[model samples]
Target: MRETPVLVRPGDADALAAGRHGDPFAVLGPHPVADGAVVRCFQPQAASVELLDGDQAVAMTRVHPDGLFAVRLAAEPARYRLRVTGRDGAVVESEDPYRFPPLLGSLDVHLLVEGTHHRLYQVLGAHPRAFDGVTGVGFAVWAPNAERVSVVGDFNGWDGRRHPMRLRHEAGVWELFIPGLDHGTIYKYEILARGGVMLPLKADPCGVWAERPPKTASLVWGQPPRPWDDGEWMRGRQRRADRHAPVSIYEVHLGSWRRRPDEGNRPLSYLELADELGDYVSEMGFTHVELLPVHEHPFGGSWGYQPVGLFAPTSRYGNPDEFRAFVERLHQRGIGVIIDWVAAHFPSDPHGLHWFDGTHLYEHQDPRLGVHRDWNTLIYNFGRTEVLNYLVANALYWLEEFHVDGLRVDAVASMLYLDYSREPGDWLPNRFGGNENLEAIDFLRQMNQLVYQEHPGAMTVAEESTAWPMVSRPVHLGGLGFGYKWNMGWMHDTLDYFSKDPIHRRYHHNQLTFAQLYAYHENFVLPLSHDEVVHGKGSLLGRMPGDEWQRFANLRAYYGFMWTQPGKKLLFMGGEFGQSSEWNVDASLDWHLTQYPVHQGVQRLVADLNRIYRTEPALHQFDTDQRGFAWIDCNDRDNSVLTWIRRAIDPHDFVVVAGNFTPIAREGYRVGVPEPGFYREILNTDSEWYGGSNVHNNGGVEAEDVAWHGHAWSILLRLPPLAVSVFKRDG
Candidate 1:
């Protein structure tokens, strides 16, 4: 049948031809006319066009030489499809994207503007949905400053002239639904900024999967409801994340942990890591594995720190589903997964959130408030409502969708202080004339509150170095609301003392004992993290102050000291087996070191320390409370020896820990005990199993009535050389 057509406005016709129309919905698609509706279609490559409403096909008249086709329909609207014959003689038919209504609901708009939409990712990304009984992908973006936005990819010749999105002005968002488009389709937003200026094609901010770096395009992906296999881990995660629980985290950088040397030295896929990493960590007796950021990033050298796609797992390992399976596999093996989350700042990658929508949409406009000088990155404007919603929703996405047990927030100190890494005059103070970042504090509090409220068992740790008051305290008590804080002071002080020669160690005794002055100020994790071993800082083993055997002994004693410390513990990858060299991101760890007995001994010592830390209530139960720790003899500077007692909630359950720092064996060393009983010798770092001198007490020691170091009982025994010993009272 032949169809009649009406003329379009001259300005609208010109703007549509150039793909710079501000309000394309008003001119294109189905519009109301005098007595009927006019359907205008733009197909620059079409030889001819036909409108199909089921059984009837009406020929559309070409109204313009630039390929504008239109037809007049009945007064009442009817669903229709456009059949186009390309100049190349190929023909195809599909639903017109402009005919579909706006996909975002009013509630979404209200919540998004209010910054309370914790689930913003669900509404604003490319989603494959059934619209009007037709399968297509719904694309939405928050680019209020753009004159026109279109979905461009191979499907439309990557042209901005096709599939212009309809702008929902209330929330400053644009959305469209194109039929027959689904997962695995590569696409990006072609935006025409105001004043007819074209910007670079921007990737989707809410993409769940993306093409690998150097191929910077957002891939259309959807997440269906997954039948998770970690129900048992999910059900009891709360109890496992208690303040007193034994949380020995094994920190790892996935790319360099252990690459397959034969496969062009590429990193293991997520499926391989799921089983291999899970087995290694489980056998090592660690309670959890804290992965470096798994977020999709352009540069692997950043080790996932400078991420571009917050929601998408890095395709360098595997797809998102395989990453999910990795978490499930770890959970199945009784080990929890904690991902390093970076919300403080982001890299200034052009295709990323930088200058999105031709404005400072995600980051601050001012350099003092936005730029990270140290990292050459951009800081998020935490004061912005939508930015807060986006980041908070991302935190929940990892916990909810991927089933991760916790999030160890990266560079929290940088977020807390406005003057961090800045000169005196280069920073802006808060309204109260302080350097604290008030907006970032608010965002952190809200994120933590929502995380704990939503996922009871999941923890949020902060890598905060400063003495921020109550960082791990509850939000209601005026705290920053973190589950744990890294004990950076202890790590630095102890490493400094260990690096010193034992002959000069007496002068640095305060370094080892000064941590207890503020130990209970926060829930602490004694982290020997990746930061310690990278960038020319040699391995932990190389930092010791003695010959090879004495270095091994010092390391053993140090692990024993750390495990029995008054906090949870963390060790970076390769630290367990004593990798000889500093960490290199371009290559696998020195895995061959484990074949030697000295390195194997260190690994065995770490495993036993984990076992004792978990099995003994006194070691972990009072980890955050002062009531659980007491100084037995902290003033023994002359001998370079220190002794302490750890108590559980029950006074009867206690263990005494003693360390001899020097190479001299201190036989008949009298150590104070809380009770009169036979103390069972549990662990001696000098045992032959750990490649140490076999200088240890036989069986156990019985306490005497002799008062010593303000204790009611005392025990005299052989103290090993450059080693630590743990003794539990057995009555």
Candidate 2:
């Protein structure tokens, strides 16, 4: 054997063996010295090591007691493999991990440093990639304050010493390329903090797949993305996403929508939901399905509001590919998919982003700026460039990677204000002493601009309860730049008015008429969402007035009124069948309620309403246009009755709606019509088929050329109790 020259410095060798080397690449890879080249590696479990060059094996000397081995090479340094003999006498051969070049390119470093990398997910995560004609996984993470970081996983026996990473100071990113590791290798990062303390092992922030809850490790997922087959859907998507389109959404929490009772009440897998959920949404005739947040979260109790892995699909479902199949299946059934995005804040789990890298890197140091008191979570530091880049890239990731049609941004009001849910002195103000979160506003505007620019068909909706102005307006016009805004006032007022008894409804008549005062201020979505049915609030049917028959009638009439209103519609799950219990994330919806005729009738009426809403142009063509809706009579509070007309772009295409809120059938009620012709009764909420008294016009009535209620023609008909009816000019 030839003499083995000292390759590494005594201090460097000790650092490597001790697993505290800041730059392991310098000591543990092929290094060129003055005399020759040397290959050194740290294998804690190896008793001895040999370098394999071509057909020769060169024995390496153990430089340090903890299995640090090194040997000088005769020829110029080239690619080589390590044949490590373990203490148990088993020999294994693999390419040296540190000898490979940096996984991130110079351009990637520049972009990441500048925080403008829109596709950051692809670069800064555990990626199974091919490099230098060898297949392996490339690991990268941003941990600027860490003294040292190592990739610990099954291949390395969860030993940080086996694979300490090389830090690129320019981007604050640590990178390593292991030659033999492939997909499905579970891994985590062991970070040595600045104070020489070992922080908890952290999961990959950009991991695309993760371990199931309670076992918080990220998986190396290199599976090719599902090949898109919905070209037709993608092409016409922009056209269909207009304000004039029938935009009814069915909001559902996938886990609790329908669970397998026999299978320990577990939620259905993504692949199973691909068929069942898609089919149900299509059959119900909803234009889109808006799922509650599905990003990986630790607790099922939070209902996915508190997410940790922003890039990963939760393993409670199937893999990311299966989630893609679910989206595809929905598209195949002519339904669009929308997911809730929680970008305002994140949880404080040790493995999450809280106190990441031994610093408040992702959040603010001041609790006033960083803490969300309502959620007990840490708010993202919106002013920080890297944080903004991370959040914006995450939004694009969901829309582009998953083929999602829209994102309903949750708690936008919280993001918009610095003093949200905080006492006056407990909050901090902006640079201009304003309560507005200027940085968050900038981030939101940029995200919306990029989403609309990059994905033309995609949309963003804001769940902002505050009276924020122009929320749905374009960014160029100094607005927040959302496609739609949830009409909180309408939902609140409608629910409040309907919950009151009919005898007292006369005084609350303004609640029904006030929504129209500013209906066109923004592109509004009338959201009867899960917020109404959760958190101790009873179900939609449970809050109604009167006995069984009257309650059902009030529900049907309220539904009819909502559909005829000049806005897009959104209904939470189980509301169609009048479910009488509050929502519970741990249990499936009360599916058994549909067995009774009363509940079945409610379900049928909702289906019919959806069908009519989708088919009738007058009801949807001018949903956001002020000229579409006109009040015929709003001062009829004495009779608890109201009449209105909805029109399409062509005023000739219109429908008349008469609603009687009181429980009395007015047999000789007269209503105004637009034209002198036969008025066809298209829909009547009082029909016996919908569990109503069936007190409606026999078929229809001819409009006489009689001036009534400021109209050219009038029709006299029987208006059913607590019912709403629609009339179309057929002749």
Candidate 3:
């Protein structure tokens, strides 16, 4: 022993050796005492410890048998390093992590305590930082209920006792700045829970990057590089995302969209997908590509709906920077990106937020309010302000950090109703004794309002199935404040009518015309989404009930109708090529099916539909305005035909849609026209190019001043069998 231990207390040394000390910095760092500077270091496995002053060794006296070392030195030069020698004669040298100053500021602590820190990612994650000229990783986490939290990783051989973090009680956060630890460090928090029970090691909740799942560790990475080149695109997005503009979305499950068979059918990386997908979508003329949830999930079967890392893009593709490049590429090609965001529920994975800090910190305490029976997951406790801040910050993380164009909030109906998927007495109601989840509603409204306030051009769409009134209206007007809502009713009715046999089509004619009854009630997106193809609900092409040719004709007709209808449009991946089999998440889309003429025809029709929908103002300029649409004939149930006029805001410019459900072409069909002019058949689903029977109206038909269907003029036309024909008045 070189010097007498002066300021070290026996209890503090024992607590440090036992790894139960909440504030290691107060005991193990250089502290100024009455006489001089006393430096204490805890090295449980070390046989000896020495203070190193540029290769000069000053021996430290062992104050406790468990290896707590202290050295009393002159206060002139307080800064020192440690040279620790293990019992096996193995030696290592490192800077003292405890000597550095706090990385988080007063403002950060204030915002964190107030639960208003939208950029919690900046303050509470594993970030490579340099403090006091010493570079290392700065780690912080919110674990108010935890008795002790330690940063465990490969740097310390995954030992909790080696680095017990310092607790900032005011903000309920634990932080540690480990010198010499930088990027690529795989880490987890080993927490001694509130009840003295050692819980499972948990991954970082705000991790920006994570190990590819099955590994379950958070990787330390710096901020993503700033080389985005989509300034013009981002600036113009507000104009393109307007309600009056056409939004034809191609919803895709990225992992299953395409795969390289030679590489064991592995999904392409984000970098590879950027070029291939960008070219394909731009060529197809789709305005946006809605990616099925890309957040980090443990199980692939959940398709990212059950997420653990809310701020991390799934490492299944690439790192955060690569995802940024993907978004930049899509922006450069003028295609918007919308990611499915699942804030409704999360799986009960031990490594996830379940039992986080060994308490119900992120979710509810009661089973009635905590559990999601349908998914076997846990519902979030929206009543908690910190939890709400966590989720809202995550929403902005995708929007501002990754530059996503919008968010389609998944399973909104589940979040809206407290009794969702629950029977009587199986749920808890709000103070109002209503089924509505008031806290969740408040969270949703706050999230939407924050998104619009923070980002200018980005938007939000709700996948709400129930008849929740005013879902797409503003929050100030007593509504949910979403930019768009998925019209589940229209999707259901249209799919049901199309699935019926042609012989019984007349009985369900109302299904085809019923959508207009409440089309403008909310800004809607007609979604033929990934949900329709999974769980024994066959692919969109398989849903049509008929022989091969009739099936192709039916699908083409339905897409044409959906595109020309009064709302935005969304179609699932394989529907364009008429995939014969149901969607298998493990495999790629049946791209080979495009070789068949029938499938090729469907793909061709969808391309033309996107092109026409984007180019023609009459088809989209007033999608939410009632005056844009008028039924020419809704009473043709005997023939199972539907005809309507779609007018532009200019009034004179208009396009007419005529749909025939039966396979019998009607020749010399008299249809009413708004004006006496030359009407051109602009798009025909029955054209031979689209693999139909080539029933033709030639090119143009002249409207005569013969009153029919109470119109100013009428045109004698040929209605194709099981097809939809769109007409435009020529100038």
1-731 per-residue lDDT for model 2 (tens digits): 23433666889977777777898987888887667788888888999999988888999888878888988886645778899999999999999997888889999999998988999998999988888889999999999999999999999999999999999998899999988888799999999888778889999999989999989999999887768988788888886778989989999999999999999999999999989988888888899999999999999899899999999988898888889888988888889999999999999999999988899989999999999999899999999988999999999999888999999999999999999999989999999999999999999999999999999899999999999898999999999899999999999999998988899999999999999999999999999999999888899898999998889999999999999999999999999999999999999999999998889888888888899888999999999989999998899998899999999888799989999999999988888887888888999999999889999887788999888889989999789999999998884
User: Candidate 3 on 1-731: residue-level lDDT in tens?
Assistant: 22444658778888888877777888887988877788888888899998897667999888888888988777724467899999999999889888887778999999988889999998998999887777889999999899999999887778898888888899889998999987888999999997678889999998888999778899898764787799989999987888889998999888999999999999988999999999999988999999989998999999999999998899999998999999999999999999999999999999899999999989899999999999999999999988999999999989988899999999999999999999999999899999999999999999999998888698899999988999999999999999999999999999999999999989989898888889999999999988888899888888898898988899999998899899999999988888989999999999999998889999899999999999999898888789889999999999999889999989999998898989999999999998989999999999999999999789979999999887989998999999999999999
What 10-residue stretch in candidate 3 is worst by lDDT?
A: 1-10
Q: Which stretches of candidate 1 lie over 4 Å from their true place?
A: 1-5
Q: How close is candidate 3 to the true structure, as a TM-score?
A: 0.98
Superpose all Cα atoms of candidate 2 onto the true structure and report the RMSD in Å to 1 decimal.
1.5
What tens-digit string does per-residue lDDT give for candidate 1 at 1-731?
22332557667777888888877778778888777888888898999999998788888878767888887877635688999999999999988887877899999999988889888889998999988799999999999888899989999999888888989898889998889998888999988887787888988989999897778788987657669999998998888889878889999999899999998999898999998899999999999999999998988889999999999998888889999999999999999999999999999888898988888889999899899999999999999888999999999999998999999999999999999999998899999999999999999999999999999999999999998899999999999999999999999999898888899999999999999999999999999999998888899999987899989998888899999999989999999998889999999999998999999999999999999999999999999999999999898898899999999988899999999999999989998887899998899999899999889889789999999989889999899998999999885
Q: Give the clash count for each candidate.
A: 0, 0, 0
In model 2, which range of ten residues has the least summed lDDT?
1-10
Q: Which sections of candidate 3 miss by over 4 Å? A: 1-7, 87-90
Quickly count the clashes in candidate 3. 0
State the lDDT at 279 in candidate 1.
Answer: 92
Model 1 residue 683 CA deviation (Å) reads 0.9
